[model samples]
Target: MKGQENKEEKMECKKEENLVSCLCTYYSCSRKGVCCDCIRYHLKSRQLPGCCFSRDAEATYDRSFEHFARLVQEGKV
Candidate 1:
């Protein structure tokens, strides 16, 4: 039980640290500061996380590989 509690505490600390550097613009996502969860969720949907996109591109909410390609071509990614 103590070990589990310690693990939970460590996770919380990491989350707090991650929040400081996370650039995801979504305000209500449960995985906002949790990179692993966000990546897994997006990958399952054949998309990438918001942080992978540029500010303007990310604002469009089009996280598809196709969009990324466009951004890359436009030198925005």
Candidate 2:
């Protein structure tokens, strides 16, 4: 069906646009501009995307939920 064909076509990601605000400090990472891929990769590793952390925290590369919780408790996030 025409509608099905439209739905089946993958939509283009705004990688360039997303990159403008992407704060992840890992310059060599493949998922730098692709938010969904970054999220999936981190989730699989039991971690979170770097942008979920503050700039300083993100730099520490501690993307664990426990670390985020500590920041939350400290009101530093």
Candidate 3:
């Protein structure tokens, strides 16, 4: 039905958006595992990982944990 087709199209668009939003990538790392590793590295540095941020914020490299905490405090998360 037309409604079912529209729902599938929307899901596809969301999947593409998620892929486009991904920021951290290492050729040597498995794609599925890279996110976990990247998050750990950022956390150890007192920062939030790229995936934690919106596209614009991630582009700023403002991955500071303090920034993340502040966003959370402000209910921006």
User: Which runs of model 2 end up more than 4 angstroms from their true locations?
Assistant: 1-9
Please report, in order, the local distance difference test score of every candidate based on alpha carbons. Answer: 0.83, 0.89, 0.63
Task: Please give, for residues 1-77, the per-residue lDDT of candidate 3 as tens digits.
Answer: 65465343322224335556576443343442345556677778888777787666666778898877887898777
Ranking 1 against 2 by lDDT, winner: 2
TM-score for model 1? 0.75
- Clashes (candidate 2): 0
Cα distance off (Å), candidate 1, residue 4: 22
**Candidate 3: which stretches are off by over 4 Å?**
1-21, 25-33
TM-scores for all predictions: 0.75, 0.84, 0.53
Q: Which regions of candidate 1 deviate over 4 angstroms?
A: 1-13
In the range 1-77, model 2's lDDT, one tens digit per residue, is: 55455456677998999899887999999999899899999999888898888899999999998998999999998
How far out, in Å, is residue 57 in model 1? 0.9
What TM-score does structure 3 among the candidates reach?
Answer: 0.53
- Cα lDDT, model 1, residue 74: 88
User: Given candidate 3, what's the lDDT at residue 12?
Assistant: 27
